[model samples]
Target: MMATGGRRRSSESDELELGSSGESEEEMEDSSEDDQENEAEIQRLEEQLSISAYDYNCHVDLIKLLRQEGELEKLRSARQKMSELFPLTEELWLDWLKDEIRMAEKASDRENVYELFEKAIKDYICPEIWLEYAQYSIGGIGQQGGIEKARGIFDRALTAVGLHMTKGVAIWEAFREFENAILGTLQPSAGSILTPEQQEMVNAQLDRIHKLFKRQLGVPLLDMETTYAEYEEWADEPDEFVTQVYKKAQQQMEKRKPYEENLLAADPPKLAEYQAYIDFEVKDGDPARIQIIFERALSENCLVPDLWARLTLYLDRQLKIKDLVVSAHERAVRNCPWIVGLWKRYLLALERHQAEHKIIIETFEKALNAGFIQATDYVELWQAFLDYLRRRVNFSQDSSQELEELRSAFSRGVDYLKQDIEQRFGESGDPSCTILQNWARIEARLCKNIQKARELWDRIMTKGNATYANMWLEYYNLERAHGDPQHCRKALHRAVQCTTDYPEHVCDMLLAFERLEGSLEDWDLAVEKTETRLNRVNQQRTKAAEKEALLTKQEEEKNVQRKKGRSEKKAAKRAQKQALPGDKRKADQEEWGAQIDQPNKKPRAGELEEAEEEDMSAECGLFGRENNTRILETPALQKQKAAAAARNKVLHDNSKDDLTVFVSNLSYSIANPEERLKEVFESFGHITDIRPVYSNRGLFRGYCYVEFQEEKAAADALRLDRQELEGRPMFVSPCVDKAKNPEFKVLLLESVMIILFF
Candidate 1:
């Protein structure tokens, strides 16, 4: 209900006038209502921040709301909280700086503003912030610090972003103006030359201004021509070195202009262009320029953890500025706290720099609470923290505070995995229990405390790890390295009893251990134990194998019985139907979709004509037989028939004579023989019809008749004679009744033409 500036619009508000019937009578009442709504909204935003500290937009919205209501304290808190997690934008920093500057009353408040400026510049290289910083420092010149402090800030600002292509000129100009302002104050009189000391003061101030101008001109930035022209106008005499530096800077600026122009032409967070720009700066081999470009890119793409990581890597490897490297890592983790790698890298960076023990521990605690998505991330983070703690321990000293802390962290991590991690992720992330393994190793190898190590290994096995042969071997190896032969033999004996996955490997390990360190009776006992365990395991496996084989045999017999029953039932039904059938043609027509063919048995002489004559008489006509029979044709059958006709009409319907090729010797198990035959001979010419012969049960009978569009196409198709269909060579012969056409012979074509003109 709280209005977001002017964005919250409603139809009711649009319909109402200023003094509408439902309007508040007094402006004070209306204002109080808005204040309450804003208060509620502020509370909601703050609550959201509490729930999700990394909610970047929520923080920004809260800060904006607080600033709008002039809740100075709340605004400061909101901005600080947001900046702790995310690098603030230049706009947010400017707003924050301006507010601090306006509210700052005492010398101490001014110093706080200075500290705020320092934090702001670290987030991004904003010349405006630098300009603001310099200007703010100018106000403090008379209060406590003198002009030198202001000059020092301006100089640092120029050093940071002085090589900036477009905005670097602003900082240079501001520095010069501040120096000029100081110069004016240092001059004794308006018309007379100063005394030696005073004159020296004025000259030194002029030299500072000169050096700033020279530095500005030497750097490749936007509006260098303006700087050069201004320099020409201001200097009493021309300096060729300055001119050459200006020319060189101009050339460099021209080279950089295209990239900056692309940045301006593209949208915000132009990552691709910025990457190309970063490559350009890095190729120049200037650390200062590379760092500046990286900061500029990060200003827009702060949420991009990769960008921050790259910047930090570059600083660590190339620049080696400790503050910048630490800041980069810290900011990377802030921007991407959920990224475990970033947190790990931050811990390393902090430790590499030998940061305070308290700060490092605090950072590790924050990483533990960073709410990583994967349970493995938590495991890895704990491992990192444990490694840091272990590094701090003096192994030479038997008992140290660092060693105690490390041991405590180890126990705490294991407990956390058991209760918290397993509850959240449904299983402990460390399936191998690497943390416990490390702890045992540390206790054995560093503390030389085999008893403690043995205790740890016992816990490891009890935590759902008893069955693993590898774990047993791991414990055995550790005991062998750090414990006595008696303990080693004990560990191996327990391993042989408990190892299930590879009991033979552990048995062999125990035999090897007994050979090296056991007496004759001890070796005899070990052999007996090994033989018994192997015999039991082999017996159990043999029984399981026999049971599995029996079950498989039973399954096969059941399958055969079921299949025979289905065949017998089908046979009986078919026989009864054939015996009781009224009209064979009608039955064939009804089962047309199934393509059930008539029986292959030869009929008695004249029996077919007699049956046809009787069927015709009963239906009044053969073509009108549908009226008397239960003939059914679904859309799928019709579509199949239509597709058959579209490819080529059947041979009986065509006018062409002797164009049908009889194809035989196809694979009986081949499905869709018509389509398969067509594919084999389709390259010859247009196919007229493909009729695959099927038996009464609708099974392929290994033969079909393919009628072509022309006799030549049929002749060409005959060239595929003995060519394979479904791995069986087929006979593609002309469709001739041998008794009727004795003279007909299948002459293989040496050359053939498909007669499409026919």
Candidate 2:
């Protein structure tokens, strides 16, 4: 089959390439040999579709297989069914349209083909389809009014897509070529001048061409300079107004070029780039540019409901054009019918546009059958329709068709949720019974139908709502608003009997109500009712508490067993690491150090502080603990500090003790420790590095070394000493070798958490 019309369509070779995939002889032979297997696979897809009609990939597969087997009728049926369920993508629509156009060319009845184009265009704003439609119209130019019809299509095509910057130039060029072709037909023999009457017809035709150029130039389309060049070549001196229009369009294009460049560089589904472009256009306050960019974005990202929403929202709030707003909303639902919010807005937009009752109902029915992913979407859509119906009814009057319609809709919607939605999703999505609540309110307040309202409330409570205090409050509030005091009192008695989650609150509300609207006898009766209920509830709570205590004891025993198991498993892992071969890198042994599995515990029995302080300096990087006892016992930390000591010996870039500040006493749980220190200390001077010390198990040790460019920067940073951070005062002191400067330390307080470092 040949793909024809505009350049956007595939060439004959490209179509053949596309068609060859379906016509592979080896594939056909395989299908022939495994006919039963192919049939079984097709059956599986069909069964899946029956189970879930919104299985999009299943439909595409079925269509492809049917087409491969030359089952044209079945393929057509499959594609039609899919299009009815959801909007077909551009590629799918293009292939379907090409096939239909091929059939239409062979047959005489082209009206079906025309109707197909209309349906295809409604799916999305595609310049390719509009261009094809206009080009297809040119085939019948010899018929009466056929030329006029073709020109009308060209005009509509320009209107729909002329604002598209990237590919819009193609449509403009196509339209101009069409006019030039017609202009050629009107010209006389070579070098011939016409009479006044014929010349007038010629001038009118020339003026039409001039207007097309003028209109095309006014839009800020890509490659618009070429169109200007064409006009300059056509008319020796272009009109001053047209030139100015061209200049303004170029200025707008220049302003939009960077955004377009971003879109070009971005991959398909350029949602982020398009969003940025849209925000810029919106800020630029050009509705035309905003709409064009949004359309371009949605072309690849139609599945995203948010993009559709932003476009429709802008149309609704800013554009304020009924046709555009309604069309955008309808397209939104068509592309994403599963989205409840889009359908909700579609309904509201229809009502805002005063769409006829029949169309609104039809759209609502379509929404109900759209195969929403969750049951809640169906309920919300129903609520929106019910709101529409309720508003239409004239509640002031006794009765009307509008009132009956609203009542009928409410009944059907309630049944749909209670039965259909429940069966589908295993629960009515409306757990609050919001639709029933709304209906009850309408019955009691609007029509003064107290008995009907009571019936609705009774239905509401029976659906597991009787145990909720809010449900009882809703019913009591309704009765107080419309019914008498007896109903309200009766409602409270039923609530106290049935409400479970918060029966005490209902009882209190009952007492308060009696104080306001009941007699002394009623008040006494309410008090007795409350006391009896509270006594029973308290007894039930005591038993529950005893049961919970037993569960707690069992849980504690399980936790103790789990902790023992984890400790044994960790012990085994440490033993295995210690058995590693000598060939293992030293870093491995350093990482999994001896005593790495142990925590530094406090002094036990008769450990003398004086003896621990004397042993602290015996090791290279041994440091004092809070009570001046040697604490850091990990071999990995000792090795690491020895490396730091070697680094200090080199005197690299003058990064010695004077240029470094020891940051300590911060909370161990401080997040992003080094970065936070940089933020706090970099103001003094350029920071070289921030080394936040961590425990062997990768926990922050509540200390780090901050190295600066100069000694004065370190001195300046000392102003932050004892400054509180993360609920602890920081200790900023010079980074010194504790063995060399034992007396430089002011004091080691036993009461304070002390960390001595090198």
Candidate 3:
């Protein structure tokens, strides 16, 4: 029992000690919990203080929290507090006004809300603050009130900002926000109040946006991709801000649906679709539709000739009749005469139709009149006409008399063409070889007069510089046809001359000439001409080598001259630098030394005299050396000789006079100089002196003049003029009759009119 009691006491003491320790730990835990609560409270207070430090930030936070909590009234309360706390800050005032707007909108008081926002924005000078306020008001009062209120608000803000117009950032931001407000209100669902013209203005603005930033709202498919980012930035807002974007997309999709369906439902081509088609006689060929497209294309802002021509081709393909095809082509030509391809196609179609000779002739003349058939085209047309004649006339079937009559007609046409070409050549002596050759060939083949043909060709080659390869070939063919060896040889020589400077042409023409002659001399001459042409080509190729050699020599000489010039400049600079400084220093030191020596020097009678004598000798010797060095002679006589040589060269160059003058007496009169001048003459000297006594294009002065080197020559020309020249006589006489020679003033007036006519 005693042991049990002792053990129990000890256990009780230990338990007690343990309980005390537990109590201490419990107290510490309680203290720690209290400290935690105190710290949390302090942190909460610090956060509240920091948030409410700026009234603007405080109002914003409160509004955000109230909105999250669905307590708009509390948001209003906080915003009011913010406005009262900082009434001068438009941000706080705007926030308060926006909260009021939210409340008013919640109560369906749109007018009151708009008025509040409008007043706040107007009274606010801060663009950014007012802009933000306007955006928030938009959220509460919907787009109409928001946009209307915003436009007025922003206009005032802009006017206020105008005072500080140099503030570009503020001005641009205001404009951007204004545009945003306008865009936000632009939804069909938002119930826009725009009239038709106002809607059009909005649409135009939207189109401009889409065009400038293609991927944004209203861009075309063809717009470039570079605009995507810009469009994305402008459109990177909540759906509420960009509500009408999807509506536009839907409208676009809806507009395209019918066209797309029409395109899709279009049937595969069927022969039956070509209806109203006389030839193919099918249904639904859509010729009328194609014609409509053609007409529409013709009516486009700028007519496209190619498109019109293509449409005509489409119509012809659909109709599938040669007559309709030709008709459509002719219609296109009449409509668009400047379209050469269409005209050509029309001509081709006419050929296909096998039009009568008279019709073809009329068509050709009409084409020429319309300025559609160029020289080359005329050649093609002529060939086609000949082919037609060959096919229809059947020379073997026709009698010799008919054949001769046909040849006579061809001769008349050739004569007309030769006269035309000769007139042109007389006007402009250097006529194109192509026209000349065409004229010659037409005469040769159709006229069937070999002499006339040869004369035409000779005239062409002599006058038109007809050295083309084809000319030589034509000449050779003519010679071969005439069975003239000398003519053939002459043509071959001309061919050689034509190819003399071109090695490739030489090789080809020489070989051809050899083949024509079939002689060893011909072959040898060909080889010689070809080798000479080749050597000439080589020399020409080496011309660059000579130029390079000259350039290299010039470069080396330039380098030498540059180096010498640089060295001379450096020497002159150094000499000038050295001479100035040395002379200055020597003069200063000599003056000082002389002053010192003069004061200290003393002399006996004979010693002073000898010293003076020695000084005089030294000065004389220095002066003599300076004079000898400075008095060098220049070679001006050499320049005088050069000038004399140049003068003599000028004298020699001017020693000859190559000009000769022949004066005509105005007293010698041609009765009708205009009529006589119009008469054809082969040479310039055909009339001794031809002068028109006309004042204008058609009027004639009474007295006319003509003179010749010999008086009898003048008389003979006057007789011919009277007999054959345009049915009028030209007066001719010596200048002894001074009455016919009018005063200079009268002559000047007539001459002025003549100049005007000419």
Candidate 4:
């Protein structure tokens, strides 16, 4: 039965091995295809990069593909070349280091891995990289002095990033675990008596473990409570020092717990919360904490250019650590290559740090290759580069390489803006001709080459600037300062004729120039030209004024006629409304008979007024002359009678009758006063006319006359008196011509009182 079982087990093992081998073969085939595809993609990206060398995304893609293909030689070369051009990001460095480590088969092969580790650490102080470095060094611990080397690496790692509040715990724990493993190896056999040598080794190992725990417990790290508990369980005796360190670490942990909790609860790219936490860390002024917080923020907000910009600016301005500041700026530009501001700032930072001239030039070239968003951006960038070039030149030298380079850059800039920028944007980016002006100024002021300056000014003028008086004056000044008087006069002459925008100013400049230096003939000619131009300008102004006056007169006459017609219609409607009920019935009967006798005949104005008055007298019980006079003599009634008399005088003088209401207290800046008044008065009844008073200059005078179709409509509109319009209380009152009736003084005084009350 035993033999049978052995045979069966062997058969099953063979079957399992066969199945595993088949699966491995399939995976190899799949990986081979994937490698081929990745190689093809790498080739495509290389082709794209050849066409556009500054294609940052393509560079990243090509590097990723090469690393994935396990083409070790090519990958190394790619990474080296990219690092030279742009700083390698943390993830890329890790990938490169990991690939190198995996390929190391022998102990000797670890040399390259160590070198790569050094390069990776310098790029960014990533705690993970340090931990990986320390762990990888442990594999060679059996070699000569290997243990010491690994310990040294661990010590360096701790010193570099041991203060990291979050990830630092891992490194500390790894250090302790290595020591514990060493202790386990040093222990004597279990349940066996130990020699003096064995006991001494055991005691030494135990002391090392205790020391490691003591050191780790002094620093506050996340999950350090677990480390403290383990140390307590492992200790042979109760140690007061260990307890004190644990208490201190626990206090530190509690203080940092809120920030840690916030970071833990946040999702990826928690930029705002991270910034606040970083600010708190900065306020604490602990360099370790501040750096860790920044790294934490950057790990999540790596794509955020402004965060990178802020970090770099801080390093540049405050820290002033050349390596740190330069590395940060390089990374910022690499991540956000399209941002011209970042590239510009990078250039300035390099200059500020006194970086080599060649590096600065290469960086500027890269910036130009990094496409900007607008043509104006190109112009501004070119100007910045040109300014840098100009600063390198020594003006005292008659002709130097720097001066030549400066001149060449100026020429290239103008041509680039004209050809490249204009073609792309459909207009010249240098609309103000600033570059050419700068070139002209440099030629005249520094090089003392008036001829070259003249040529630059010629180009500037040809570019649609010749018509501007300011442009002409600029050229004239340049000539007067650098060239002979002949050129200055010529510039002024061209300006006088070509400057349409400010011809008078240009003419006056010409006359002044002539008076200063011109011959008598020149002065007389300038005067003649000035007189002719001024006369022509005056004639044009007079013609415009006359045409405007004619239009105004026509408009006023039309408005008067329209007002008269509207008043007549409104007055007729009011008279009909004010009629007594009996009078209205009688008038309807008369209208019915008239329609049959004289079909389309209308009542005369005088007859309508007489009928309306008779109806008013009968309704008010003032049919007798004596009673009417008595009622009119009352103080309150006198004011009403005076207002009525003034309104009647106005209506009669205008040959129409209507209850025209006056609206005051309107805003002086009110727009469309007629339409506004119509909007308000039309709600009561049909608005017959609106006449907003205006100054002679056509500005609103804060008042208007609004005529309504019926007396009831006018009375209803009075309810709107003292109502607000445009933040001012509007006064609506009957339009009474106070000038025609002396007794209207009382009503005018009452109107004044009402205005004052509001």
Give per-candidate clash totals: 0, 0, 17, 0
User: How does residue 374 of candidate 4 score in lDDT?
Assistant: 76
Which regions in candidate 4 have their CA more than 4 angstroms from the true location? 1-96, 106-109, 118-125, 141-163, 175-220, 224-257, 284-288, 473-489, 500-758
Off by over 4 Å in 2: 1-54, 62-78, 105-108, 538-758
Pairs of colliding residues, candidate 1: none
What does candidate 2's lDDT look like per residue over 1-758, in tens digits? 32221113456687578668676767756755776676688789889999989877789889777666545666678889998887877788888877777767543547777788888887888888888888888887877788888898888888778889888887888888888888888788988878888888788888989999999999988889889999999999999999999999999888888988988987556777888888998998978768877888888999889999999999989988998899899889888877999999999999988999999999999888888978888988998999999889888899999999999999999999989999999989999899999999999999999999999999998888999999999999999989999999999998988888998999999999999998999999999999999899999999999999999999999999977876886686466456545523343445335326544543433333322432233332222323332344443444355445544543323337788887878787877887899889999999988877765334667778888989899988987986788777788876656565453354434214354421
lDDT of 3 by residue, 1-758 (tens): 12321111226666568667765767757865965664465445436745654434435555555544444544455555544333334545655565565456344575666555554433223555545544554454455455556556555544443222122134434445556556656645665467897788778666544432322323111121223334556657424433355345345445434433443354322111222121221222435334432332243211346655665677555665765576666555555554456655665567667766677667656654444323344434444444444444444442465455445545544453456534544433224444445445544554455566677678767764455666667666776775366667666666656643343663675577577665887678777876776677678779979999999999999999977876886676465445664574464456446646675455454344334433333333333432221211112222333334434432111111111111122222444433544353212233443334333222334444333344344333432322222333322222322243344356456545643443
Best TM-score among the predictions, by candidate number: 2
Evaluate residue 212 in candidate 1 and report its C-alpha lDDT on the 0 to 100 scale: 75
Error of 1 at 215 (Å): 1.1
The digit string of per-residue lDDT tens for model 1 on 1-758 reads 33544233345555366447566567747776998999899999988888888766688789889898877766787788777777788899999999888878987898799899989987777888998998888877885556779889888988887777878778888878878888888877668877899988888888877877788889988777788888988787857898888899889889899999999997556887899999998998888889889988987887787888888878778876678889888878877778898888888888988899999999999998888988999999999999999999999998999999999999999999889999998989998889999999999999999889989888888888888889988888897788888888887888889888899999999999878888999999999999999999999899999999999999999999977876886686466446533564565555453433543333344343334333333344334543554433333334344444535633343334468787776777876777777788888889977887655334566677888878789877776776666565667766655444343432222111111111
Backbone clash pairs for candidate 4 read none
**Cα lDDT listed for each candidate:** 0.79, 0.81, 0.47, 0.77
lDDT of 4: 0.77
The parts of candidate 1 lying over 4 Å away from their true place are 1-32, 47-54, 84-86, 184-198, 250-262, 518-758
**Each prediction's Cα RMSD?**
20.5, 17.0, 42.3, 22.2
Q: Report the C-alpha displacement of residue 538, candidate 1, in angstroms.
A: 5.6
Best candidate according to lDDT: 2
lDDT of 4 at 219: 83
Which candidate, 1 or 4, has the higher lDDT? Answer: 1
